[model samples]
Target: MTKAPVTPLLDRVHTPDDLRKLPKSELRQLADELRTEMIDAVGSTGGHLGSGLGVVELTVAIHYIFNTPDDRLIWDVGHQAYPHKILTGRRDRIRTLRQGGGLSGFTKRAESEYDPFGAAHSSTSISAGLGFAVANKLAGTPGKAIAVIGDGAMSAGMAYEAMNNAEQAGNRLIVILNDNDMSIAPPVGGLSSYLARLVSSGRFLGLRDLAKKFAKRLPAPLQVAARKTDEYARGMAMGGTLFEELGFYYVGPIDGHDLDQLIPVLENVRDAAEGPCLIHVITQKGKGYGPAEEAADKYHGVQKFDVITGEQKKSAGGPPSYTNVFAKSLLSEAEQDNTICAITAAMPTGTGLDKFAAAFPERHFDVGIAEQHAVTFAAGLAAQGMRPFCAIYSTFLQRAFDQVVHDVAIQNLPVRFAIDRAGLVGADGATHAGSFDVTYLATLPNMVVMAAADEAELVHMVHTAAKYDSGPIAFRYPRGNGTGVELPETPQQLEIGKGRMVRGDEKQGRKVAILSLGTRLAESLKAADQLEAKGLSTSVADMRFAKPLDSALIRKLMATHEVIITVEEGSIGGLGAHVLTLASDEGLIDAGLKIRTLRLPDLFQDQDTPDKQYDEAGLNAPQIVDTVLSALRHNSAGVEEARA
Candidate 1:
């Protein structure tokens, strides 16, 4: 259990090419150093740790055996690709992971040739790898597409879809099922390793093919029996019947931590020419770290931590997160109604519904990595007169858009969509950013979209969504702690198309109006304060609902104010677009009233602090002030002169 003070072997290798040059005997030492390096780097940077730790040896084995950059290795979800990143010429930048202007937390094609396909979402690697493999085959090229996908990702239907069509790629496609969590086939030991190596070996494969030829020449009924016998024997030993049925040549249940098993089995698969192969490798999450191994989720996602004690940096006590507020509020609602239930697409803790699950196990459904199914399942529940809350991240909900449209919105099913992480998420970057939910969901018919300005607002929204039974209702909240506002003693039901005013109305010279949505209310208020000081009367309205457009409030603002602006923490076609449409529809723009919309820039923003991201998106207080000043046709100094 002693850690190395230096990564001597790892220091000499900058890329997988360098790694491939090392002797097979030295690989174990190299793997040990790689593990230490990943641990040290993640401990400093604070990102996905446990999954990366589990894959250290498996990563080393893949890079060592395959001719990568040409071989095309894709990691499913890519949170587990840190060690892969370190081995593939990104070791020096490993410490900069998930930071602004630094390496991405997931696999990105722009970052390195080693990452052939960019992936942050689960169950995509196999599909992407199949494309690469089929491309190489069609081009008559010299490469294989290797997909290292975890078992958690395999619960999704896409992996099997890719496998069913993998026969076209011949031996060019290889799937390494990284069995780290929710193991599909949990048998891994000496026997498993032996069988894995034996099945994948040249001699065993040669004999099987020879037996197949003999069996094909037999009588039709006997040939069927022979094929069944051969398949069942391997299936009984390796537990690969499912994959084999999907047209994959299956190997393993091999110990992933053992370099000896991984390297040889990978080598056998590499040399084989008959396969669209799958190698099942079992590994432990948080493999090399003691504290991580001892904890649940295995320190899956973490803040910066001490390498020695494995203690993460504690947060200075602050307000409860919006997620927590939502969980508690939903739990309270559930207590009142027996028919109310909750569902998450394998994101119990992230959505803060783990506590809800604990409280009402019978009503909670964790629909393992299948967002498509989760939405439809909730619709089914709602159709039967149960109030079902389907809590999911905005980014993930994109996967179930069809179901949202067909099953919920079209049918007018009463399903509540508790959307968490509804804006630009900080460290997880553009892929995980929940930027499009408002834009996409708002456009759908029979859909009501609301965004919480703060924790208190989230509580009210949750209650409102629960009460709403006419159609699909979705409420969005951001990904951080609340604004520390006092919660209402009892949650209130907000009127569907109404908004509340926060600051000045028609009193002080009647000039500017700022319509705020989501968590940008604080910034809008600050902008109003700045505008007031600059001799411009400003009104701040929290337009809580993104859909239905608060027609009364918006029309009133347009009538009273000369200049109007809309601000929201979403992409181009969100609150701003809707407000502009409302103004256009009413022919209010023809009356010489100038209107501008402030929203997230029309681009995918990278990872950074929430404040920096907002600033970059031009949705901050300063930006809001700038938008108003420009609309009024006055510079800061000019505004002062006008006031004087």
Candidate 2:
């Protein structure tokens, strides 16, 4: 284990209040110590490193200048909040980030009073900050609402919408545009290019230039006095015309890493009594770390690493990840079909569309961090007779639910939705868990939803979506590796709304039938093995399609088996609810057959290993076996009572 870095100035600080007690001279030292401490902590725990490193100086300056907890400071996306966490009384638990029962990787309202608004999603901070500012004005609160948003987050429409309404908050809202020229990937879109131009314009005025400009407008005696005023300092540095047009007092293009420049500028902005201010602070994503600074992605997210060498720990070799499989399959499909195009909402690498982007540059569209636009854009493409694959993570797809329903599903566009990270994503916690996609998408009319049992199945589903032109079709797959299934050399286009029985014949006296959806087939097969050992014949069926569910297979299972259990790695209204509704409509359950549903519990599960999360949610192999046994016992009791 690596020893924690020596943080002399940081050791003296326990909270933001402790930071405020220190003089301006020690702030630079404190920032350095804070950076070292943060790097060390993240090195052990393995989390968002580059973002926190970029915001070290800015974090110190904000907490020191602003009266936090009273002054609501919200970090956009909260990936950069590690430094904020350390300063706001969480330094003791900093090493426990993203662990089972430790500090969350992102800012959580329940975790700290300093975190006024919790966030994991991007571009939400400005709107949340505006709400806070407006509420504080109504309540006559003393503090301001500061939103530190990234340049990448600016690509989303929500930020601009909030900026447009910022005037309502009066002088209480402060938006700090943390421009590092990157989000998760190198930022795309016009906003990115515009920000780059703004940074490179070289129009930033120094303090002397500010004084000279102010001195010209004042009398000789007042001229000297005017130079010392906060207004003069603000006027010198404040020149982002684009933001000014949006009703914000634009104040920056300042050095974010330089505490000397940041502290005074922020102090001036805090005291200015302006309506709404936007401080554009320039920074490098991986500011101090050598390895991160040199790397293309700047080590955005990393595993546990050597502090000295900056070498990350290697994963144990296994089957290719589901993401890689999807990428390969999509590329293969794209090779044959000229009409097939790909789209991602600022998540090229995360959704495995980066490879597709490389292969078909002209055909791929990275629409920044705009999921809603991506959905509608894909709809437009599909309407124009082009096959558009809008590959998005299931969690993020929630943001564009309205678009899916109104634009695509209602119009019956042939848009292919490749939803990655379809189930519990460990460490990111409930906010990022893809638990409700099945419920949301499956509920929509003209929408076909499928979940892959393994990587091979995912390939077939991709082909199926490409071939199907009736309406919007979506296939969901899990976050991690496949179940070691051999990939088919030539992918087959699966028949829509059909399921395959992986184990046991329907006529082989099967007492219990396990209807598995998504990647829970592995656990279902395990449960079937356990049931067979216990002298109870069990059949396992991989019900791939959630929407337009395999009604024929479901009927066969209902007719043959005395006990039928529906299992999926989703929430209540997903596979189980669909099955129950179908059976009830068909009058299948009216017979003396026992039925049970296994799914993620109603409440949101916290950060843990995928296996542990499934166990907690009662969707594991043992839980499946228990559900089957318990249902069988209930049926046996009913039969005996009737005989008596």
Candidate 3:
């Protein structure tokens, strides 16, 4: 059993101001309590437990050394900010984490003053930290700015872009590389292994600076002879000088868990840093807890669990999630065809491609958190006549928008895009929500956009995408479980741009219709049922394709129905926007009819359960019914008032 932490010093810390009053000796005890508190709090709420646990000592050391709020400390990806948040006056509200109207799961500028730069995505810290550093420099302020990023996030080209620019410009900036050897899963590519080797050898700083000093201080005649000898000697001792060549003064391979080693180096670097610096601190991902340390990826994000047993609390099971279904379907496809291959940007498990990777090892590629490279690489495979499917979360795919446009769309490559989490992703909040994929992808020439109405349709769409070798085709699915519809074993191909009418009674004069896109079909059908009981006939259509919309079905529905409502699981520039565009072009608005679009509201959604968020956005069945009734009431009153 784990011993209870000493807590007297912790009770005194209400804020960072209070923390400053404590002596360095008491701060050590306080760090112990902070770790205990984090463990206890996350045990109840069950969020990003492993990341917070890994950074407890680092958090305490940073706060103890630097005067924050004034000193801008940016956290890359924000998963490791739980300990920081608890330390900075959010301790009492820790229980309300990821709940509706409570503490956010990730860093938010609006949530706290200490979180100066908000982040939910990886590899953004370097650029954001540079911005703050530049702003401080321009303002003639003498404040320190530091960016703490992980090795996994370092794979992204944007981080390298920021590092390249910072080194060239020779700005006085600090970048802490939190090396954990894992990013949800073990990191891929040679760069990851190279960094691992550099850290493992433990002579990065000694050899690097010694070589520099030897090269600079040598006589002119002897310099050329010494340079080659030093290069050979350096290679024998440490690995390549990638970061140094990029313009950073590299330091460390230090133990992140040990405060003694970390604090002194940080203090020295903080005082002596004149140009851009990279301090690589090696740490275990799930440092404190045994279960988490053993299964780092599983504990990265978890449901409520028993702290003692480390077993997840069961919440009633129903249908398999869309992710699971997609994984099975993709695996099934690759089983039959040898040419089909799968790829993801550091999310083999998240995108449900782990099974595919296992079934066909030769056909699977797990590119380290580099979305831009993933897309262009997929295009290269397609160019060479290989069927490549690039499956990525909708939010992450936004990182490769330019590549998707320039590389894939321009070339008209037959790249299949499986865009998972393509709606308001609950709990993870705005940064992880997949809102803009439909609008962005739909606008591209020769690009096909699709949304799955149910799990069966998702299987069909996957098959359709695999078979179609014309151009780039994308199919988006929501974050959670399917609607319990029985999936088909034999996959069927769907027409590129057709909409299916699910439920309706258009013969009667009570002609009001709800047009649904994607998973909202079930809720729309439920609303139609409620409307029918209230002596109003409602027609519901499930629009599978967003890009090439079924003009025939839409035209038929509009002509028959008095009121037309467009509902979607996504945002304003999505299904609703596409329907409006179609209606305007067909001159249906001038033909004496009422049309309104119902989508996710135009505001950043907060952390909540998926059902609660859908209800909050008026996308649930009861909420949809209320919206339709309100529209009908206004339409009826307008007719009555105009006659009067």
TM-score of each: 0.98, 0.91, 0.90
Worst 10 residues of 2 by lDDT: 196-205
lDDT, candidate 3, 336-420, per-residue tens: 8787999999999999999998888899999989999999999999999989999999999999999999999999999999999
Better of 1 and 2 by lDDT: 1
lDDT tens readout by residue for model 2, 1-644: 77768888899999999999999999989998988998899899999989889999999999999988899999998988999999989999999999899999999999999988889999999999999999999999788999999948989999999999999999899999998873332323344334333422324334435656868888877886664453444433444555765788665566788786777777777776557878877788878999888873738989998889999998889999999999998899899999999999988998888999999999999999999999999999999999999999999999999999999999999999999998999988998999999999999999999999999999899999999999999999999899998999988988889999899876665788999999999999998898777767889999999999999888888888888999999988998999999988988885569889998898988998888999999998888988876776643235344224
Candidate with the greatest lDDT versus the true structure: 1
Q: Show where candidate 1 strays beyond 4 Å.
A: 1-4, 296-298, 506-509, 640-644
All models, RMSD in angstroms: 1.8, 6.1, 4.5
Rank the candidate models, highest TM-score first: 1, 2, 3
Per-residue alpha-carbon lDDT of candidate 1 for residues 325-442, written as tens digits (9 for 90 to 100): 9999999999999999999998999999999999999999999899999999999999999999999999999999999999999999999999999988899999999999999999
In Å, residue 614's CA in model 3 sits off its true spot by: 1.7
Q: State how far residue 248 of model 1 sits from its true place (Å).
A: 0.2
Candidate 3 achieves a global lDDT of 0.81
lDDT-superior candidate, 2 or 3: 2
